[model samples]
Target: MPPSLVTIGHATFQSQTLGDLQSGSLNIFLPGLNLGLHAAPTKQWVIVLAGSIKVYLQNNQSEANTAFVSSGTSGILLVVDTKDVSPVGHITETIEQTALLFMPTANGTVPEHRVLHNHVCAGEDLL
Candidate 1:
């Protein structure tokens, strides 16, 4: 048997919007897709409106850490520190042909909501 991939569930979570609220674009990712390791272009929040996605992230502490999110999963993604002295950044993939809302940050500044663990586990845990 293969390792079961994590699937996020729906539950209430306390959160505050980070960036200045403004109109942004909507993106749709198809199914059976595997996106390469990459980072957010600027400080922004990625809201999973439909379907699910798996975020692959690595920081100074560990590698191979992933957060699975479905509809209602949202988080603040910071800029990738790819400097020679820094660790490699993270990546994301559309697990269920996800639809996303890219909420832009204010003046490209880091949001008030800090990325405590360099990654987020939004939404609920799937049973």
Candidate 2:
């Protein structure tokens, strides 16, 4: 499952345990900051607070390959395209001033999660 719905302390909530979080950072990306065909330095989760970004797969250049990650947890990203691990990566461009939280996992490991639909989870899926 993507996010499990569970009850804890008489309260039900949607949650998913990723893994041990290393030292993280709240980053502020200014406008026009574009990393052309860049891979992630490490495996980390990114939660957007404000603004938006566009990510396109390295080999593909098409609308369907473009991912518009906007200001929300709904589009949470787990970037793991390291230079040595991955031959190619994605192209990232900032849409505006963006505030993001980068939480890198321990040992550069990525958490396991089931893809719901188009890599998106709906409210009904929780039930």
The candidate that achieves the highest TM-score relative to the unseen native structure: 2
Clashing pairs in 1: none
TM-score of each: 0.62, 0.80
- The residue-by-residue lDDT of candidate 1 on 5-101, one tens digit each, is 4434865444344446544779999986876755455556667788887776653223336776677424333343443323466667777777888
lDDT at residue 2 of model 1 (Cα atoms): 17
For model 2, the stretches where C-alpha displacement exceeds 4 angstroms are 8-10, 115-127
Scanning candidate 2 in windows of ten residues, the lowest lDDT window is: 118-127
